[model samples]
Target: MAVTTETAETGLVVRYSFLWPREHDRGEREGRKDRPVCLVVPVNVAPGAVVVFPITTQDPLPGRIAVAVPETERRRLKLPGDRPCWIMLDEANGDVMPGSFHLVPFETHPLRYAYGRFSPAFMRVVLRTMAEAIRARQLRMVQRER
Candidate 1:
């Protein structure tokens, strides 16, 4: 199901079809295709549109923008089997549906699919990391244009 007024708020975590590229060969290996993502963009900013960062349990790769999910926060959110998760900040994916944001459905306890929302503090850190990554990317782009 898509995101509604109740679930469109920032800091909400939802599962969606995320096309993650492989580390070695982006087009070859399949990364976490479907996973949870944190909504970073406020609902007011873009009512229907949303900006989200993908979450993964794999260790942060070199040169890839990512934010480590602290143990305390992970426990609070009840992530998958206490495994460490990281939020990728290099890019932001969106899920817009009929002039509204959409979020994939998920089950609790067993966590068959999507989990749920995350803590405000964790979202804050994610936003900060995203900002830094955007700046870095912009800088690199500017340099390339020179």
Candidate 2:
């Protein structure tokens, strides 16, 4: 897939090879297949580098950072109907290649790929949630320092 101006935007969703945690000390690992993800950064910053958040269909587990995809918004985005999907905030800072971002590209790259994007309103909510998470983390760090 080729990264273009049209496809690069905040809240854009794409299919890519996302890194997942291992059970033991095996280190982080990404599956051979591509998975859905959300673009958390604007496209104007860099050519190929952009921050992303992983999207999953698994139920939200305790202690895991995640945001549920509202059914209305899910329908608007036309996400898969197989099961409920959620954005994994804990897995947000992934990067992609310059030519890996796309809005339904012809060929998907092994390390990067994309399908579609989310609406502006949805993106705003995502950004707000992320900001709140960061603030909470900062507060914790400050408390620990005291």
Candidate 3:
């Protein structure tokens, strides 16, 4: 099924071309690859915008903030449980739902599809962690074109 604005809720994991802050600063308009990203904000009706954090298997660099994905959660999302992954909370991408070019779809599907969604309990934890960063003014958001 296509990922409509209603389906693109907070905690939804979808494949997106997430342009990093550094990349945006360098004038690069596109991300290098399509990676799993967790939607961190609700899709607002006025602009149809949402915030997303990239999920990576690589370890966070020194002084960077990240949240480890639990093994149980990985299994639930059909991800490799043996490998470690984290949600990058120090930075995020802002994009519009329903019309974003960088939002990739599943191979078997023509429209945008979610890999899965994080449980509400886990999502709360993520939001709290992100809030800390936001309050500290440590989070950088890169707004992308729709």
Candidate 4:
């Protein structure tokens, strides 16, 4: 279960939200549009917390997708200070051109997959390949730093 702090308004951070994955509502289903849907909630970035990066549905992005909060524009949005809104930041990859989100942000969680998505075996292979790629890039970055 996901835990969200009680906040009057949810601050938008990099086009993502804090209270996310709100249950589906077909009757309330919206027509095709471009926007990320989520609720408002409080976020606590405690010390010693290892931030977990959420994956995106879109692949071959310019960078890795990580959950981040708003630091600069929280006050302007009239949200509860700096809420922990989800954000996609490129680590090794840089400068992903912005695009429209038809619905919610394509988070990597599989529950919301299409009726027939990629097979399990394929998923394993893809994950392995990604792991290797990340390792190689990290090593290259270390070498460059040295």
What are the TM-scores, per candidate, against the unseen true structure? 0.69, 0.69, 0.91, 0.22
> In candidate 1, which residue pairs get closer than 3 Å at backbone N, Cα or C atoms, i.e. clash?
2-102, 2-103, 3-102, 3-103
Q: lDDT of each model, Cα atoms only?
A: 0.59, 0.59, 0.84, 0.27
Give per-residue CA lDDT, model 4, range 1-146, as digits (tens): 11222211222122222111221122222223332322212136432121111223333345443333233322333323333443332221111112212213335552231111223443344345445545655211100000
Tens-digit lDDT track for model 1 on 25-87?
A: 345322245577776554465454566677789887688888888888777666666688898
How close to the true structure is residue 50 of candidate 3, measured as C-alpha lDDT? 83
- Candidate 1: Cα lDDT at 146: 5
Clashing residue pairs, candidate 3? Answer: none
What lDDT tens digits, residue by residue, belong to model 3 across residues 28-61? 9999988889986653455567888999999999
Best by TM-score: 3
The better candidate by lDDT, 2 or 4, is 2
In candidate 1, which residue ranges exceed 4 Å CA deviation?
21-32, 42-45, 97-103, 107-114, 138-146
| Best-to-worst TM-score order | 3, 1, 2, 4
Worst 10 residues of 4 by lDDT: 137-146
Clashing pairs in 4: 57-106
Q: Per-residue CA lDDT of candidate 2, range 1-146, in tens?
A: 34555665677777655545331125433344456778765446555566667688888688766778877767776666667789876554445445542223335355334556777877777787777767666211100000
Better of 3 and 4 by TM-score: 3
